[model samples]
Structures are given as structure tokens and as C-alpha cells.
Target: MRSPNPRILYTALCLTGLSLATSVIAQDSNEEVSRIEQVIVSASREPETGLNLTLPWSRIDDDALKLTGAVHINQVMQRAPGAWISRGNGQESLVALRSPVLTGSGGCGAFYTAWDGISLRAPGFCNVNQLFDVNSEQAGAIEVIRGPGTAVYGANAVHGVINTLTADPRQGPEHGYAVEAGPNDYYRVRGEFRAEHGAHAVGVHFNGVSDGGYKDNAGFDQQKLTLRHDFSGEQWQVTNALEATNLNQETSGFIRGFEAYKDPNLKKVNPNPEAYRDSFALRAYSRWSRETGAGQLSITPYFRRTSMEFLQHFLPWQATEKNGQESLGLRLALSDSIESFSWSTGVDIDATRGWLREVQDDDFSPNQPAGVHYDYEVDALSAALYGQANWQLTSRLGLAAGLRLEQNSYDYDNQTDDGSACAPEASACRFFRPADREDDFSNGSINLGVTYALSDDHRIYLRGAQGFRPPQAAELYRLQSGQEVADLDSETITSVDLGLRGAMGGFSYDASVYSMQKSDVIFQDADRQNVSGAKTRHVGIEFSVYWTGESGWYAGIDGNIARHRYDSDANLLGSRLDIEGNDIDTAPRHFGSARLGRDTALKSGRSLTTELGWVHMGSYYLEPDNQHEYEGHELLNLRLALALGKGFSTTVRVSNLLDEDYAERADFGFGAYRYFVGQPRGVFLEFAYSPE
Candidate 1:
């Protein structure tokens, strides 16, 4: 194993610091320094901290968590604009996003996303096993990088980024723990008690969850443990986090394709579906930084290993996968403006290896046995250099520009029998070919955006950016002939965005319109000349407005309208798919939500905050050709909170208030789309006590 060339990274850091000190000087702080619980980024991954607004951006501090009850990260995300979700028996079935890309399946592309400055999207489908599905209670402050991000972040940042800032030792630096229980046989208990003594802080957090799901046998359980430490001094600061998480749950199935909506009770009797999933993961990271008047330069090294086992009980299959990654990077930040310009740059590299194996299993019984299972492995390496700059040409006008160049290489090799053919039944026969393919490619993406002050409370902006995603091995190679696929290209998209923001009568609002034409899309070809090839166009509008005057007395509305079309004409029900008229598959034409809340003061500083929220999704046609369609959906959520003292508070929330039935997601067959009930109007309550 080879480590990163720190000698070079360190040299760059020194040069960057010298340039910063010579070019720009730190300006005096003037704006009110408000410590807000929520931070909403302005199109960039950089969050705007200390913001108090009702514009779909809600900050949940420890007190608010206790007052507006929600414990899980997923539940809190639903409160955000464009937050949509659904769950399967495996607890892995839940997938939520803001206008994610898709094929016959779901979540094809991502926007700006980062977990402590590292990308979270794994190679495989970023489904259940991949999501950092930890309980929200363990987090310190959940920072939401709102709206589409065109900034310099990791791969998964298409829609936006939600960075969960874990807890530190500062809140108490002593022993403390939390436990809670609720209806539906729901039970969860987490404890985080830390200790600090003179420049050193060390803490441990343990979380466990298990609940009898609203539907029969739909519950799940997971236990996560973490050890965190931080050291602060005049010359150096160090932080470390080591985590281990394991998931164990029974297979849960939902009616989809045509089974659901037909028989609402399909959730009973286990549904006899061949769905199951299990995974274990360990992640560790260490960061060290030295303070320079210019800024703090840090080095981060991380390692992660994840193991997954999936069994299709209803079917004749069994499989297991293992993934590992080693990454090292350096960050040099300069917060001061150099003669009126600000900039930041860094370089990073990631090396990953993943493998999948098919186990011999027969669903029919011991009388039936399959022979000679196959194993596949892939090696991928990526290196990228990125930089961002903000130049204030004048006090009223600003310019932002960024670019990233990435070089990626992939190699996939597997065994023969590469599958005795894609046949349902066959005797021992070596009818497959061999696979030894490798490809290396490079690409560059750029972003240019400008923000101008229209007056005092109004601003206008114009932005353009490009996004891309490389197809995984499975999508590139599907057994054929005697040899496996060895050639494919990356998918890319270019977008043009127009936006407007202003405030009126204590109301702040923002709206944006964007159009994108994507090319090099991977698709299944008839001749097998290329397993992936297609084109698409997406156009949409997004708007949000909110207020921030009195506690509880607030309201906000937000939503989007999109039109997705397929290029390179095809047939929809025997007719050439009409690009100009056909609706994109699963891209809901409309998605909107609104919320209103106010605190009813019973006495001085003693009040109850009650909130009502509603979300609507426009009807979407199941197929791209628009042959069939699923009706749109609407959901309502209600919450209440009470604060008794400056340091104590409690909150409760009920989601899916209407118990609406709809599909959190949809694909083709084996899809799992159903009128699955929401979290059963879930009720979550939390209590908090703090000393400042």
C-alpha cells in the first residue's frame, strides 16, 4: 500500500498561505453574529450560517429536536422542501430526494453532496446499505445546503447536500444519555456521554433502534457506535472519529407493479416476496490542522469497509458483496479577501475495490440445486483537482467561477459461465464467456455564476454548470455472447439557470428556472453494439418563500414543475415516442409543499408552537411513452412544541397526517410500488435540558 505524497501537499499549503497573507487582509466583522441552528447554502456547498427563516429551511437544535419531535434523519428530512420517501420491509427500501435522475429503477444521478468534505455515494445503487441512516438525535446541528448545488463538492451533489454535524464534547463534556419510545411498538435509545479536561475532549455515542412497523413484520433494528475526540491548541488542532454500524432485519415486501393498490393487505403473511438485505460497515477518519493567519490548512485520511449479503427468498438466488476504499486529501482555505478576491483550492484521490459473488441456492428445495456460481470484481481509481474563486469587481456586483478536472480508470474482471446464459432453467453447462475489461477516461466540468444586488432586499442571478456520472460495471456489462462488455462512456449534462430573489412585507422568496440537455446516456441497445446509449432533456422551475418575525408565527411555500423528454425517438406503445409531447418516466410534473406555525404564548417566555404542513406531488405517467399514469399524491404533517425554560424544551410531530396511500418510488416489475401506508401518522416527542 502506498500513502499520499504529503510532502507535495504540504508545500502547496505553505505557498497558498503566503499568497493569502500578502494579497488580502481579514476584514472586521460587522454583520450580527447569530448562531443559527440551520445553515442554508446559496447554490454552493458553503452554508449561510445564522439564518432564521421559514423558507423550507428549518433549523433543529437540541431544544427544537425535543420540542418539535422527530428522532430519525429521514423524518427530519421530510420536513424539508422536496423531501419524499417510502419504505420497504428491509428498511432499505426507503429512498428520498429532490428531482433525482432515474431509469426503469430510481435515483440515477446526484447533485452536490458531502459528508465532512467527502463524497458519500458508493459505487452501487446508493440504496439502503449505502445511506448514512443514523438517528438524528445523535447529531449536533444538521446543516442543509439548500437548492441545486453547482459548487466544488464530491460526486453526489446534484439535488443538494445535507451535512449532519455530529456532536462534540462542548455541550457538557460530561456523562449524558437519551432514551425514547413511541407507538407502533417503536423503541429507540441512544446515549452520548463525554468528558473533557484542559484542551482534550473524548466522547462515545451509542444508538439502537427497533420497532414493530406499522405494517405486519415491517420493523427493523440497527446499532451504531462511535468514538470521537478533539484536541485544541495554539499551534495545532486534531479531530478523530471512528464508527461501526451493523444492521439486522427481516425481509419486508410491499405490493408493486400491479400487486399493490389491488390488495391493500398484501403486507400481511410476509407477502412471500424474495426480498432481503443485510450489511455491516466500519468507517474511520482523522484530521490534523495548523492555524495560519491566512487560514487553517488540514490533512484528512479516511478508510472504510462495508459488507453486504442479500437473499431473494421468493426467488432462486443468493448473493454477497464487499466494498473497500482508501482516501487521502488536503485542504488549504483562505477566508480573507485578497485585494477584493477570495479563493480556495485542493486536490484529492480515491482508490476503491468492490466484488460480488453469487451463491448456489435453489428456491424449489433440496431436490433442486444450481451449479457453478460466479464471482465478479472491479477496481476503480479517481483523482481530481478543483478550485473556486469569488471576485468582488464592485461592492454591488460579485462573480463566482469554479472548475474541476477528474481522471478515472476502471477495470472489471470475472469468471466464465458468466452465467450459463440468462435462462431460467438449465443443466450443468459451461455456456458463458470470459471478462477482462478496462477503461480509463478523463473529463472536466465548469461553473460560472453571478450575483448582483438589485437594491436592498432584492437580488438577481444567472448561472451555468455541467454535471456528469459514470456508469457502474453492471450497467456497462450484462452477460452476452462469450465475452463481456469492455467499452462505455460517461453520461453528461449541461445546464443554464436563471434565478430571482426578493423580500416584501417581511416575506423572502426565491425562484429559479433551468434547462438541461443530457447526452451519452447508457441504454440497452437492440444490436448489443452498446449496452448503454440514450439522450434526455430536463426543464424545470423551483420557488420558495418564507417569514421569520415572531416565534411560531411563520409560513412558507415551495415546489417545482419539470418537463422531462427522451431524445433519439423510440416507440411508446408501438408509436414513435413523442419527445415534444411525451412525459418523462417518474419525473413528476409538479411538487409543492406549504407550512404554517405559531407559538401560542400562555405566559412570558412560556408558549406552545403548533405547526401544519402539506405536500403535493403531481400525477406522473409510469412509462416514458405515457401509456399509463399514476395519480398524483398529497400529504399533510402536523407538529407541536413547548418551551418551559431558557434551557428546557419538548416537541412532538405527526407525519403523513392524512395517512395518504402512494408510492414513495416506482420502477418496472419487481418494482415495489404500492399504496404503502406512511409512517402511520407517526408521533415523535423529545425533551432537552441544557446549561449555557
Candidate 2:
């Protein structure tokens, strides 16, 4: 499980043999090599053409999201391929796709996040740093589907799915603005607008940031907003969206011993300086499609609200929570075609009302109680019905299938006075409360696929899937110590994938290999009850590549090489040693990112671009009886842009560029070892304006 970094696997096998030898020398140079298809929309939710998608997809376009003006969101979701995201401190984060980076409370219900395709928190409430509540810094695209996207995304999509696409106003009039600055006292501002009139279109995007801490009193301030509207006639078409987010943080905990993120003054020490976090979110949606006759029909309606308060300060009795939620939803879809077979069907409905509160002002011991150790309220309902089909069995083969049926219910409602919050024999308390309850979960998902086509720029595929989630609501009413009713079950994953994808001349690639198995899997044992089967296994190889050589140069890579073990053998955390095939804590057998760029035009007309980036992290095992490890890190980044034509522009960025002392996350509980260090060598600058 530890091998990788043979000089980045020999530069990823010499850039996969130089993109298969320049795509067979540009198909024998008789010229003509422009294919360009690539289109995606969260698979099966509409737009398609990810080379006849049968699964494993990736996208992160929009000019790499404005040259990755990202300050987080793990810098554009690690450029896709088997994602990782990690990064904590400030805007916090944790997500691993194709599994493992998962943490408790249902481990964020096993991956599924969305903005344009809704679901940003509903299905039983999830939030492992809820992707900082959307706006993906004004996303234009960010699709990813690594594995098991729950038979077309229903209930948590088990091990993958991420959408976030917005910004489309008939692609017309536009306006932009930017300002940025970096290092500790950072600053940022961004804005965007789009317009169109004839059939109405409008868009707006926003951003805001303020940072100051590197550690000693961590800092953060954030904001995001999005609004969009579009309407087209001649047969109904409407789209509307609204998004908002806010965050105020000053949280930092973790900086313990062992390797202390390579020291440097304990990596900027910040021992929970009065930890904090505050959050807010809002969402709205409307999408209606047209052309119907039992065929192309779509409808969407949504709303969401969120609120949060933090300072759990990594526990040991530092409680202080507060949560919120309010939601309403609807989605319906139908598509049709017969002869060669094509089909689509959908239905989803959601409802939520949530609340939580925890408190502890002192009294850090006596079974760790202070007061109010949990007050709850929940009311969740989710429903789903899905279907998909495709067949083309000839023109080079194709076939696909899907199905989903889901239901989730939770009624909960206990505002104190359930079970242990201490006092009744103190020693057996550690905040357990669960009294009024009602839970239900019914799930199912399925998928199958096939694809052939060997020429016309490659294609080959195979897929199989199944995914599920349902057991969150704070993992069944937040219990602890004297547990109470958390006989959980729904958590599943089954997957298979094999692949090759295409595009020639200018080079493009997608590669895959997968295997997965996950079952019941819900933990907390070692007496803190709340359990479920527990099993895991995942295998992987993932890749993505791009090239655009004919002069202005470009290159890309995204990576993965995985393993996530522990299939059976448990005790949750009393560690009784012997973990089934180990390897799972912070799983990372390999990680990736790479890019190289060039563009020039100057001669007074203005244009220049330069880029270089590489990021890698491979070492793993920080627990799960694998005894502790974390020797991975690599980073370098640089960017520059210049264009001074009337619509002004400027950019410069340098992140960790060679100043590496890493650990953007690492841990090994209570017995020591922790981190979240990483972040050095900063440099940033930006200024922009647009009009053309």
C-alpha cells in the first residue's frame, strides 16, 4: 500500500507515453484534428456527451475556474480525478471520493454534493464541512462522478457525485471584477454579471474573503452569493437560482506532537484559541424544461436554509453547538425516445426542519458534562424514484441502465430530558440523549453499463453500481455513553468500472479501473454504541489528461491510485488492535495534480499566460492500527497572467511554491499526533476588469 512517488511514478509514466505518442502523431498528420465534444451535466441529469458517458466522469472547466482563483475548496477539488479535498482550518473541509477521508456523524453520508443539481444538504442532513455551502466561488462547471453515483443521484450517492454548475446566461453580455491579496492578512473580492434580453437572461455572482491567521488564532470571513435567471420561450424553459453563504471562523485546534507538521514553531501553534465558527446558507431553485408529449419534461423547485455555530474544539468537553436547517424540495424529470431506446424518469421530494443545540461552559470532567449536552429537533423526509435507460446497440455499441428507489424519514424531537447528560450516576455520561424518535430508511439503487467503439477517437467502458445512505440525523439522535436506539442499517456501496475515453489530436483522456464494496458501515462502537455492519474495500486507478500542443502549449493531469481497506474486524475504537487489512485512516496511496501552461500573443495587442503547478500527497496511515504514518507532501505552484488590453487584467499567484512543510491534515487521536498545518510560501495578487 505504500509505493508511489517513483518520481511521481516517472512523471505518470511519461505523461502516459506522451499522450500515446501524440495521439499517433496526430493521426498521421494529414492535418484535420479537431474533435471537441465533452459536455456533462451530472450524468443523466441532462446534457451528455462526455464521450457517451457510462460513468466515471470529471470536469472542472470554465478555464479551470478562472485559472483557479480558488483560495480553498481544495483548490478546485484537486482538479477532479478521484478527488481528495482535505484541507482544514478556516473554511475547513474533508471529502475523499471513491472513499476514505470520511469522518463520523454518518461520515457526511458518503459523498454527494450539488448546487445546480440541488442536494446541498437535505437527505438526513449532511455536513462534513458542507463544501462551504456552495457558490464554489462562482462556479461555471465542476462536475465529478467518481463511482457509484447512486443510480443517478438519489440519497447521498454513496461514494461520489459533486455538481456545482452555474453561470450561463445564454453566454452573452458579461462583466467582471476582481481584487485579491494574500498571505496571512489576505483579502479578496470578486464579482461577475451576465445579461441577455430578448428572452430574458440574467446572472450575478459574488465573492468575498478576509483572512488573517496562519495559526495563533486562526482566522476567516467569507461570503458568496449567486443569482441567475433565464427564460426562453417558444415552449417553456425557465431557470432560476439563488444561493448565499456566509462564514465567520476563527477556529484552529490540532497541532499536537509527533512530527508536529514538521515543527517550525509547532507549525504556527494555535491551541483552540477560543475556537469559533459561524455559518449561514440559503438556496433557492426553479428549473422547468420544455417540449413534452410524455417526452422531455422537467421541473424543479427547491429552497433551503441553514445556520450553524461551532466550537466543539475537538471535544474533551469543549462543546458548543447550534444547528439549523429548513428545506423544501421537488424535482421531476421525464425524457423519451423509442426506436433505438432511450429513457429517463425521475422524482424526488424533500422536506426538512432541523435544530440542535449543545452546551458546555465548564465542568470539563465528571463524564464530561456541563449542561444541555444535546437538545434536538428533526423532521426529515426524502423520497426518490429514478430510472434511466439507453441503448444504441450498434453504431459502435452502447447500453446503460439505472434504477433507484429511496425513502428516508426521521422525526426525532427531543429537547432535553432523554437519557444521559450526566448526574444520574455521573460516571456513565458522555452526552447521550435520544428519546422521542421515529426513523425509517428504505433504499435501493442499481446501475449497469456497456459501451464499445474503438475508433472515432476511442471509447471502451463497463460499469456496475449500487449506492445508498440514510442514517444521519446526527447518526441517529446523537447518542453517546449509554446509547439508546441507533440500530442503523442503510449504508451501502458496490461498484465496478473499467474504462478508456477519448478525443484525439489535441489529446484528451480519461482512464479508470475500480472496484468497491462497502456495507452497513456506520460506526462509533467501543461502547459509544451507534453501530452498523462495518466493512470496506475499494481498489482504484483513475486518471485524466489533456494536452493542447500546436503552439500555445498546455498540459494537464489528475490522479489516483488507491486502496482503502479494513474489510471486517472491528471494535470501532477501543482499538483492541488487529484491524482487518488495515490501510484506511486517511487513505492515500497516491494523490495528484499537475499542469503546465503557456500562451502568448503580446506584440502590443496584449496577452500572456504562464502556469506551473504540481501537488501531490501520498503517505497515509495515521491510525486504524496501521500504527501511524504521514510522510507525504509535495507542492509547487505559480501562475502569472497579463493582458492589459482596455479590459485590464493582471494576476500572479505562488502557493507553497517550494516552501514545503506539510500536513494539511493528519491525525491519530488522543494518544498524540495531529496536524492541519500546511500553508507557507504564499503570494498572490490580482486585479481585473472586463468588457469586450
What is candidate 2's lDDT per residue for 1-692, written digit by digit as tens? Answer: 33455455637654664664476546432111222256787878887777877788887877677877888989878888778889899888989997779987779878889888788889878889998999887788888898778355877787888888987966733888989999888999988888887999888988899998788889888989898999999999999889899999999988899878777878888988999999999999899899877898998989999999998889767888989899998888888878978889888889999888988988877788677888899988888888988899899999999898988888889987988888866877777887997888898888988989898768898989898888888888888888887888888888999998776666767789999999888888788788899899999888877676655766777788889998999897737687998888999887888778888888778998898888787788888888888888778799888888888888998988878788898988989888899888999999988886
Give each model's whole-structure lDDT.
0.56, 0.83
* Tens-digit lDDT track of model 1 for 616-679: 6666666655665656566678887776766565666777776655555544433334434344
TM-score of each: 0.80, 0.34
Q: How far does residue 483 in candidate 2 sit from its true spot (Å)?
A: 22
Candidate 2, pairs of clashing residues = 521-534
Clashes of each: 24, 1
The positional error of residue 103 in candidate 2, measured at the CA in angstroms, is 10
- lDDT, residue 554, model 1: 58
The candidate maximizing lDDT is 2
